[model samples]
Target: MKVIAYGASTSSTSINKALATYAANLIPGADVTVLDINDYPVPMFSEDKEKEIGQAEAAKAFLDAIATADALVISFAEHNGHYPAAYKNLFDWSTRIDQKVFKDIPAVYLATSPGPGGAQSVLAAAKGSAPFFGGNVKATVSVASFYDNFDLEKGQPTNSAVADEIKAAVAKLNA
Candidate 1:
């Protein structure tokens, strides 16, 4: 199976990215592509911007990635209990290019935060909005207290329970 994975954050040291990479690696036979939003940097989405220059190459590339994926694994980074500005910007621009960007693609939505809420609020928002964009929500997980529960240097989940949960989610996707 082909999977496209990404963390919806621009931070170079993002825990969300770590979690996404970890999860993507767990899927058996999954040819995974881990994306960095920085690679697709685009001006904030605005009708004025679109009218002025039309769609950017990065946006087109982003869409093409989604179109080719068999599944999507997104680990959202919550900023102020909502989607990060960078990810939201990408979503807006991609939607403008194609409203049904997800187009019924199976998706494993995830979120991570340093707090106990584990980005639950943003996950809820994504679950609520996913169907509108043609996403087939397959599974979800939230990693709380990311720094405490995961070892950044080791690049693995320090908490056994969290690791097992992530593994189980990956197994389900592979099945």
Candidate 2:
């Protein structure tokens, strides 16, 4: 399978990106592309800006990346119980080209944080709105206390139960 994975954040050292990459690699022999939101940056969305600039090339490129994917693995990084501004800006621009950003591809959604909440609020929002945006959500995983649960050197969950849970969720893509 060709899986497109990304963390919905612009941070250089994003823990969510690490979690996403680890989860995408679990899909036996799958080819994965991990995207950085910074590479596809767009101006903050506004109707007036849309009128002035028309459709953004960056947004189209973002959609093109998704078009090549057989499945999606996205890990959300919550900013105050919502999407980070950078990702939200990208999404706003991308929707102008195609409302269905995921293009009906099956997806595994994940979220992580160094706290008990595990960025669950944003994950829940993503899962809830996915279908409206043509995302076929197969499963969702949330890793709480990310530093405690994940091993950076090993690039996997340190907790066996969390690792198993991530594996089970990733497996659903082929189902």
Clashing pairs in 2: none
TM-score winner: 2
- Each prediction's total of clashing residue pairs, residues at least 3 apart in sequence or on different chains, is 1, 0
Q: What would the TM-scores of all predictions be?
A: 0.95, 0.99
Residue 2, candidate 1: Cα error in Å is: 1.3
Model 2 C-alpha lDDT per residue in residues 1-175, reported as the tens digit of each score:
9999999999998999999999999999899999998999799899999999999889999999999999999999999999999999999899988999999999999999989999999999999999889989999999999999999888888899999999999999988
> lDDT by residue for model 1 over 86-152, one digit each (tens)?
8899888898888887878888888999999999999999999998888887889999999889998
Clashing pairs in 1: 104-134
lDDT of 2: 0.95
